[model samples]
Target chain A: MLSAYNITKNYQTNGRVVPVLKEVSVNISEGEFVSIVGRSGSGKTTLLNVLSTLVRPDSGELKYRDDNLALFPEKRLNRLRQSDFAVIFQFHHLLPYLSVLENTLLPFMSSLRPVSKQRVQQARAGLERVGLADKADRLPGNLSGGEQQRVAIARALVKSSRVLFADEPTGSLDKETGKQIMGLLMELHQEGLTVVMVTHEPGYASLAERTIAIEDGTIVH
Target chain B: MNLFTIPLRNIRRRPSKTLLLLLVFSLGVMSIVALYQVSLVVGYSLEKKLTTFGANIVISPATEKLSVSYGGFHLGDMVFDVQELPEGKTSQAIRSIKLQDRIAAVAPKLVSMTKIGDTSIALVGVHWPEERGIKSYWAAANGRFPEKPDEILVGSQAASKLGMQVGDVVSIYGKNFSVSGILFKTGSDDDSVILVELGVLQTLLNRPDATSFIEVAALCAGCPIEDIVDQISMKLPNTEVKALQNVINQRMASVHFVQKLALSVSLVILVTAAAMIGLSMLSAVNERKKDIGILRSLGYGKSQVFMIFCLEAGFIGALAGFIGYVGGFGASFKALEYLALSEGAVPVFAVAHLLLASAVFALITIVAAVYPAWKGASVDPTTALVAL
Candidate 1:
């Protein structure tokens, strides 16, 4: 479980201080599928980045299992990300030079812990779960947009991270492919995977067990 | 997959950039290797040629008498048990010198007083073959060299003073000698002497196998002339062996100057190569910003990212070094041939030197990549993903 208290993040743009997150607060319980909905400039992605420990809040107290994540050093944060967290980007962000299987195995390769045969098998199983088992040896460049996004999903879940943070996971896919991706997420959530997703689509946002709305960098409800 | 695959895959993905970096690095290494090898070969040949210029060491019997005279005046002084060099000792003493391979030539001379038509002149007996080796630049102005034991050669001054010509028979100590050649004017002690074979002059002077002094020409460019002199002195304890410091110093200075110049040039080339690799790596970092961010998000630490870039550069450097060494060695041989400087076979290739070159290049490359790799590792994952 993770919790935030009065998180405030600021961005400096050409000598001007712009507030992206203003004294925002939220709590994510274990095994809960939560979706954050907001307009284009509503600080939804900024909130996700802060919660994921990818960006530090200007002023906030973020806790994971009662441990102060905000006070942890970058090295500690990296370890936490490696062993306990996974992030899915809207653009997939897969390394173009690597094949699909290689992309899925990247987390294990980068982890401080030595990769085991069981971990490799788990990554293959993750790829199969995302319906990309047949495309494991193909490069990301050779895949369709939906297939690339599935590879990204497989990559995120390969290490069996406790929490998944997805930022518009199906933003670039066609409606039908987007529905398929959402269906996959729904099935994973039913299997007790904790997912925190940010999206602008009302229908996808409504699919989560809980939905939080934000307006002007503050939680509205 | 292992962590090493990422860098290897990245290198394979960008062929043109990697090849460009490899070419620049190899050219720098090639220039260094070729210049060093060429300088070594040419320096050796030049030193060998310089040995023939003149004698740098001299050996003579130690004199026991001292002159008690004013300037140009030989006031009478007592000679206490005058000692002369033993016969047949000059060659033996010279042979005993350490580093004898470095001794280019040894010319032994026996000087005796003789008369030619009522005029007293210095008759110098020399080992002709060794004298020719020492004075490689000597030439005859007229006629030809003396090939027979009864034939003799006269300096220009001696020929003019004695009114001698080729085929003229001259009497020396009741012996008839035909003038076979006249040497060119050298403007030295040689110009005033009548030259004859050492054996013939020793027999005529009634001092068989006697040598008054010896002149040794040694290649002391990389060796110590004092050591050779000391060895000669040790061999002939009653002889004074002296080194001509000025000649040896001049030769050594020239050889050292060439070597230093080549080394400095090679260093500059190496620095420029490092800078080229650094700039290229910087460009690569900029191009792969998103990839770095993704790797960080996936759990790669800063040091891991830095190491990946360094490994990529090191790989490029190793490949370049191998190619450069082989190419440079061949180039050096071609350079030597083109300069027409060396006459012998090329020097043997050293495996240790090749490995050292490769290691040096790899180290330089890794050092050059440090700043760029640090920059790559410092990329903020949040901002990088947002920008992408």
Candidate 2:
């Protein structure tokens, strides 16, 4: 569950102002499947960054469960990132030096909360769900682009995070792998996992329960 | 990030590099400490040799004194001040026989040097046992310096061991001498040494005008060292004071040159070791860039990253210091084993050196780590996120 009202983001580039988000806002309730779509330089990624709490919008009353994310301290934001949500970039962004299992297990380092047996069981189940149980011991370099994305998906589900924000989850994958990934995300959405995915493929974007189009910082609802 | 687990995990990932760092520094430390110990041992040994030479007013043409000199301008490192003669110089002081003009005082020593073949003994020569022995004298056991050349003396223990009488003509080193006064017992080489007159010993050793060495008592009132030697050489004229002074100065220069060379070489080695530490840490910082990013993204603070690299460098320094100190201590023990003064002695932890090295290591490690630690810590989370 998330809400933002009249959000605006600005950047000072070599003495010139560029607005990334201009008084645009949206909301998604629990178990909602929402897609944000845009062309290059259309502020799609910036919108996702703000929604996932990775970056705060310059002027926005961003409320998650009635709490302002901009006012949350860095430590609290880190905890929020650790357990409340997960993100999937087009690139897997897994640590190159760590094995896939270690990459999947990283969120626990920021969480002081005890990692019980159930957490390990959930991680294994996620790995099994993504068909990456055999590849758990490998590093990201050892996997293909498609397989790496699968590992990122597994990592997202390992923490049992309620909301998933994906910026082009299938952008770097082939058509068959992209379709398979979209099928998995839909299954998770049916299982009451909220997902907000950004994609270039209209076919995939149309599958979402709702879609918001953004162009040069304005939302065309 | 879990602080302990992360840094330690990185070490296992690159084993050879870690060992390379360890070995390079350990070698430096060992060489430095070992040579340092050698210098301390050599200094202590020289001091022991000086004490044992056992002569007061030890004059040896100034040039000969330079044969083994350590600290500043040397004259047997005057351990004790010379005993000034009593006031009102009279006939009692005017008793000497050779080079009478330059010689201010003359005393006699007749000592029995027992021959290896027979019970008979030959005599060695000496001077006023009182004057030389008065300042900080060697204890005499039995026989004393003879009152006359004809009167030979023996230590009391030697007298009993030789089974000879006062009037007997004892054969000593192929010369016969009458055993005169027996000495009171004192423990030292004095038991074996014999004392005699400058004249008799000159005759026995077949040198008519010279004593074994002239012990110049610089008692000439208001005279510095070179002045006294100059005045004595002027009296003799056979040995030029200028030539002798030149020789002594040359000898002193050579000793200083050798010590200077040793110091320069050690300093170069220390600098090289410090440089190696810097280079290794810098290279390691580059190699671990990806790992650093992972840690930073995982919520490791900038200070935490800085500390990890600093600890790595500091650990190397501490390890090297430990290696060097142990190496130095081992060397010192081996050298001490050769000494009769100390038997198989070993050094305990010198707290002063330990503390000094700790501070030095801390300084070097921090200096060495600063650039590398800063490089590791200044990683942009954006760029680092891309690395991940």
Candidate 3:
């Protein structure tokens, strides 16, 4: 369960204020697979980032299960991101120096405790689920674009988080690979994982249980 | 996995950057260490050479002299008396002073005028063993120091004036003594004098158990010369004990100047090394902005990112410090050799000094890297999504 009310975000460039997101509001129920669809410069990704706590809006009240995340301190926000929320960026921002398994386990590295054997095994299983088990020890630079996106998915799944935010997960992949990635997300959503994805593709938006089409920083439907 | 390992992995990932930092820092540290080591040796060697000027304190029997001029007619002073010090008693009293350990040598001398082949010359009697400690500058142009009491060492000017050669017999107050050595010209009173045994000269002068004056070479480098003079004066109340402050000040000034110059140059080098490390780390932070953003998105705190960068700088500092120390040790000997002072100087490779230097350099590098690390940590997590 996540919600945002009257969220407004602006960008400043060369002393000029440009509104990226006007007063916008949306809500999603538990276990719902929702897609925020918009063209380029439509503030769809900005809305997703604000809801995910990656970016703070200039004016908004964002709530996640009764807690106003906008008012949370940075430390608590970081803890929430580590424990209950994970993001899969379109670019699959895996550290080039780390192996696939290491990148999958990167979320757990923030903890002071050493990653447990069970946690590592879970990470390995997540990689296997993404069809990257054999490439566990290979660096991200050594993987194909499609495989790298899968590693990003495995990283998100390894957190065992309550919410998964996918920002154009197939944005950089070929058409067939993008279809495969969408199929994986569909299966993940079928397993009762809450997925909030941002995509401009109508077909992918149609696959979601709900679609919130945003135009000029406001959700139209 | 942890802060330490993460930075090390990143460092290994960027070899050229790490090496650039290491080379700059190492060269700076090497210059500093080499200057330190060379200054140490130079200070020691200069002190030793200046000590050869010798006899920083003098003790003589206190006596009075009065002028004999009257009615515009000027006359020389009255007391031409050779007021002798009780030989055994005066030396024992000097040795019994409170600061006895500061005394390096106590050479007693008895001076007398004597004729050699109708030429009048000053003949001095000295205790040979004690005189050798105070006179390290002495060198023989001819034979050697007198091994027997009946032998004499003739100064170069005195030998030339008296027409004397080594192994030639010279008579002093009707006693024949063989010249065992011709002294090198020292440009002092020593160049125009003949030296003989103290007891033999006292007996020849018919003032047995007597000494004209005593020269005490105190180890005055770190000791209080005035205090030694006061203590000696207390022990021998009948004698005048004086410290040669001008000589001590001149020598110590030279030593201090070398030490200060070395310290100033070392400070400059240290600052330059810190700046180099800082600028390079700042550049590194700029290049790794994406990594910083990614880490922050993965829930890594600002403090954690700051620590990782600082640890990377500390690692570079530790390695560079070690390499520089070893390089400096070898360079010091080469420098000493170039200065023609490596013969008797043995520079020590002390482990404590190495550890101290490394720790200091590491701290400097860490401080230098703090701002850059902070900048990296301050990167916004939202930057991670910009590529999408």
Candidate 4:
């Protein structure tokens, strides 16, 4: 389970302070699929970033299993990021130089030791689940937009992290490919994966078990 | 996949950038290596040539007493009655010393005054073969050196004063000698003396196997002239073996100057090379900002990112060092040939030197990349969200 109490975030632009998240709070239970919906500049993405530990909130107490993650040291935060959390960005930021399988195994590549054969097999299995088994050797640049996004998904699930944070995972995909990606997420959620996704699409928000709407940096019912 | 794989892949994917960096760094290393090697060889060559300009050590009978004088008041010359050294025994003793290998030449001389047509002139006897070794710059102004005991060489001053020619037969101490050569004007005492075979002069003077002193030209390249003199003195305890300190100092000074000049230039080149590497790494960091951000978001530690760039720089430096050393060695030979000093110079292939240069360049490049690598590590993980 994850909890946020009175979270507030601000961004500085052109020497002016702008409130992005204004003392908003939300909670999600384990194995639950939650979606945050808002218009552009409504602080939906900012809330997702703050919750995922990508960006620290200016004022908040973010707790996971009775531990305040906001107070964790950088090294400890990195450890949790590697083992307990996985993020899927909208752009599918795969390293252009690496192949699809290498991108899927990107999480383990940063380690000092060589990636184990068993871990490599797990990455391959992840790629297969994303329907990219035959395209493992192809670079990200050589793949279609949808296929690239699928590689991103494969990379995320390769670690088998406890929590999945999808930030507009289908923002750049075609409707049909978005449907397929959403269907994949639905399947994974049914298998008891905790999912916190941010999207502006009402249809996708409707597919989630719970939704939190934001307007002008404040949560509105 | 290991930590190094990312950098390796990036370098391979970016061939032009890598090659450009390689070329710049290789050129810098090549210049340094070439200068270093040339300085070593040139220093050796200069020392050898300078040592041969004249003898650096002189051995003479220690019993010779000095005349006493007070200012301009004349005092009679004092004599110890021992006029000369036993040439054969003394030469053998010098050759048997511990540092004899450093001895390039040993020319024995016996000086005596003799009348030539009522004008008394200084006559000097010398071992021609040994004298020629130390007097490598000596050339025939008119004819060749004396090859026979009956032949003699007349100095320019002696020839001008006596009006002698190369083929003229001159009588010295009532013995006939053919003038084999009119010697070049050396601007030394040699220009004012008549030189004859030591044996012939010894027989004529009725002092068999006698020499006034021995002039020794030692190869002073990396050799201690004082040590050679001391060793010779130990062998010939009754003789005074003195090293010409001024000549050794001047020779060493010239060698050191050349080496210092080369080292200074090498240092400048090293610094410029390091700066160039630092700038290139900075540019690489800028280009790989997205990669750094993504790696950070994937849970790569800041130090890990720093090490990736450092490893990339070290790889470039190591390759450049190797290429530069080989190129520089070949260039050194060419430089030596250009300076016309290739002959009589020994070529050395030091493996340890090569490895040290490579390791040093690698370390230098790694140090140069420190700032850029730190910048790469400081890239925020949130950049992954916005940079795309």
Candidate 5:
């Protein structure tokens, strides 16, 4: 479980301060599928970043299992990201030089734990779960947009992280492909995996167990 | 699936960039090796040529002159009794010098005047073997050098004055000697003298085991000639040691000038190569900003990212060093040929030097990549992934 309280973040550009997140607050329960909905420039992604420890809030307290993540050292934060959390981007930011299987195994490669045959097998199974088992040896450049997104999903799930954060996971896909990706997320949520996703589509937001709305860097509903 | 695989994959993905870096690094290493080899060969050849210029140090018995005058009438200066260096002790004294290895040749001469058919000519007795080392440029014009005690060599002018030819018999102080060889005109005192075996001339002059002076040829490059003279003087107090400073200074200056020029050129090449590698790596880091952010988000630490870049540069540097060593040796051979020098005692392919060059190149490349690696590691993951 993760919780954020009165989180504020600002951006400085050309001697001006722009408030992206203004005292925003939210709580995510274990095994719950939560979707954050907002229009452009609504600070939805900023909120996700702050909660995930990717960006430090100017003023707020973030807690994970009653531990102050905001006060955690960089090394501990990296360890937490490797072992307990994984992130998926809308563009499927897989390394272009690596094959699909190698991309999926990247998390395990960076983790403190030594890689083994069992972890490799699990990564293959994760690829199969995302319907990318047949494309494991192909490079990301060779895969379709939807297939690349699926590879990203397999990579996030390969480490068996306790929490998954996806930022517009299907934003770059076609309608049918987007639906397939949403369906995959729905199935994973049903299997008791916690997921926090940010999206602008009402249809995708409706699939989550809970939906939170934000306007002007503050939670409205 | 390992940490090292990432750098390998990245290098393979960008072949042109890697190749460019390798070429630059190898060029630097090649220049260093080639210049080093050429400098050694040039110094060696210069020393050999200078040795042929004759002895740079002269040793002779210390003598004192006394002026004698008869009441208002000026008389010529008279040489009084003075210490003479023992012939047998000259070689032993030369060998006792600190830098004895630098002593190239020691020619001891016994000079005396003798009559040959009512004509007085200077007879110079010499150790032929040692004299040959000092006068390496001397060549016989008519016949070969003397081998027996009764054979002798006549200078060109002396031979003409005495109407002597090769194989002509000449009597000096009632001793019959054959003219075995006639030396070419040297335009020096050598043209007016006759050369003979030391023992034969010593017995003819009735002054056994006596020598007038010793000519010493010592290699002075990278060493002090004065130090050798002092050491010789210390060992032979009864003798005077004089150094030919002009010859030594000229030869040493040329050798040092060549070495310094080569070193300066090598340093410039090395610096330029390092800069090229650094700029290339920095550009690479700039282009991979997003990839670095993604790696960080996937749980890679800053130090891990830094190490990845360093390892990539190290790999390229190692490959370049190997190719550069071979290229450098070929270039050195060509340079020696251009200088018209035959290879000396210096080995052509020294494994230790090669390994040292490789290791130094690798270190330079790694050092050059440090700034770029730090920049890559310092990239903010959130900002880099924000557009996604």
Candidate 6:
């Protein structure tokens, strides 16, 4: 289980406190698809960022299984992020210099283990899953928007990450393409991977196993 | 290809600015190379003069002091005692005795005062025949050596003053002598002197076996002049051999000073090149702000970004240096075309200068990139994601 109890975040901007999340509490189970829905500037992305260990919340209890994420050291959190949680963003965010296949294998760069054939096989399988195996040779600029988003999804799944915290993964896509990506997330959830996505679209958020609606830094559900 | 592409893309994104910066740095490197070539030419020429000047000693006599009074005779004083050519010896007599062996060649001379048309004439007698053994003064310009016992070859400047040339006759001490040759203008006293047979000069002036001074050539430049002077002084205590040795030493010192001056100029030019590299890199970093932000957000850490920028500067430095080296050597070859030089002519440009400029360019460029690279690397990914 993933849980956050009494989470708070504040930014010192222009010498004033900008609170994005305050005293929010939530929990997510394994193999569950939890989508966060909120208005713009309602702390939806902040909530996802806190869950993915990219930012630490002030005065919070964040627990994964029995390990409290708030208590884990930064290196330990990074290890967990790289191995267990794959973070994705609205933009494909691929490194422009590298090819699609190389971008998909970036997570394991820090690890001492050589990029084995099996790892490449897994990356190719993920690309095949997104139907972009043939486009793996191209740079991100050469790929279409829909094709690039599929590459991003494939990159997130290439490693067996248990929890994928994707912040508005389809926000830059059209309705039909966003639905198809949402369908891909549902398909991953059905295959026993946990997913938590932040979005503004109600129809997409409603398709999740459970939806957490937030507003003004507080959860309304 | 992956290693080279990112920075290449960054350079391409701002073509005009990058090209301008590259050219600025290249010009800085080129100036240093040009200065190096100049130093090589002037320094080598001066060094060769010092090395070759020692095999001969140009002498000026007292009394008439014609060579000494006007010839820029810088040697302060000469130690002389009435010395002889030794008994039963001919030309070999100069190097036969242990003391005289140090004397490789002798150009004996006499000078006396005489009046000619209300003006005084300094009658200088140069032993044209025996002078060859010592001065090897064959680098003459116009005519033949002093021959026919009374003929004279005057210095180039003195001949010009008298409106005389080869075969023209000039009155010396009320005696007319044909100017057989006008010596080359070596910026030395020989340009003003009249050379004649020593015996004839001594006879004409009625001073048989009288020499106002003597000129001797040594075996080599580093000859033991001090020891030789000490040995000869025991035999001729009134001679000032040490004084002449001191004069030669001072000339050598002047050449050394010029070399050091050239080196100082080169170092200043090198510093300017370094500054050029720094400015180019600084400009390049300013242009790549957005691209650096994107690369960082895509998961390249701080150190990786720094290495990438430095590597890019290194790339430009190597290319610029290579171009300067080719251009520098080519220019050096063209410069030496008309100058008179011996065979085995070594060009003055040092390979070390080219390499040093290249290394300095890279080092300074990296230093220049430091501030901007840090700025680019430290930019927050969240803020950068929103930036155009």
Q: On residues A1-221, what C-alpha lDDT tens digit does candidate 1 reach at each position?
A: 99999999999989999999999999999999999999999999999988988888999899999799989999999888887888888888899998898899997776335568888788889999988889889999999888988888888787778888999988988999999989988887888888999999999999999998999999998
**Clashing residue pairs found in predicted model 4:** none
Which CAPRI level is candidate 1? acceptable
B1-388: candidate 6 lDDT, tens digit per residue: 3435556655665678667667766765665565455445555555444433433333332122222234664655445443433211222333454656446456566766555355444667656655665444456688877668768877787667666779887676567888778788878666765666767777787666666666655432224455555554444444433335554565446645655675687567656665665566666556555555445433455666667677677767766666666576666566555454322344555677667767766776677667766766665544454442
Better of 1 and 5 by lDDT: 1
Which ranges of candidate 1 are over 4 A from the true structure?
A108-122, A187-192, B56-125, B150-179, B187-189, B192-245, B252-272, B345-347
lDDT of 5 by residue, A1-221 (tens): 89998999998879899999999889999999999999999999888888777788999999999899989988788888887888888888999998899899987776334578988899899999998889899989999999998898888788888888988988999999999999988888888889999999999999999999999998999
TM-score of chain A of each: 0.96, 0.94, 0.97, 0.98, 0.96, 0.96
Instruction: Give the TM-score comparing model 6 with the true structure, all chains together.
Output: 0.62
User: What's each prediction's clash count?
Assistant: 0, 20, 0, 0, 0, 5
Second chain alone, TM-score for each candidate: 0.81, 0.46, 0.66, 0.76, 0.70, 0.48
User: Which candidate leads the pack in DockQ?
Assistant: 4
Please write out the lDDT profile of model 1 over residues B303-338, one tens digit for every residue: 989888888888788888888888888899998899
* Candidate 3 per-residue C-alpha lDDT over B58-141 given as tens digits, one digit per residue, 9 for 90 to 100: 899888888898989989887755477998999898888877865767899998887766789998999888887788888889
Model 6 lDDT per residue over A1-221, tens place: 89999999987889999998999999999999999999999998888878877667877999999999998875577568657887777876776656788678766543324577888888889999999889888888898766777887787798788898888988888888887888888898899999999988888888898999999999999
DockQ of each: 0.44, 0.11, 0.39, 0.57, 0.39, 0.12
User: How does model 3 do on interface RMSD, in angstroms?
Assistant: 2.0
TM-scores of the models, in the given order?
0.83, 0.56, 0.76, 0.81, 0.77, 0.62
What candidate 2 gets wrong by more than 4 Å, as runs, is: A11-17, A110-122, B1-3, B9-380, B383-388
Any residue pairs clashing in model 3, and if so which?
Answer: none
For model 4, the chain A TM-score is: 0.98
TM-score evaluated only on chain B, model 6: 0.48
Alpha carbon lDDT at A32, candidate 5: 96
TM-score winner, 1 or 5? 1
Candidate 3: tens digits of C-alpha lDDT, residues A122-192 = 99999999999999999899999889999988888988888889999888888999999999988888888
CAPRI-style quality class for the chain A–B interface of candidate 2? incorrect
Model 3 is docked with a DockQ of: 0.39
What is the descending DockQ order?
4, 1, 5, 3, 6, 2
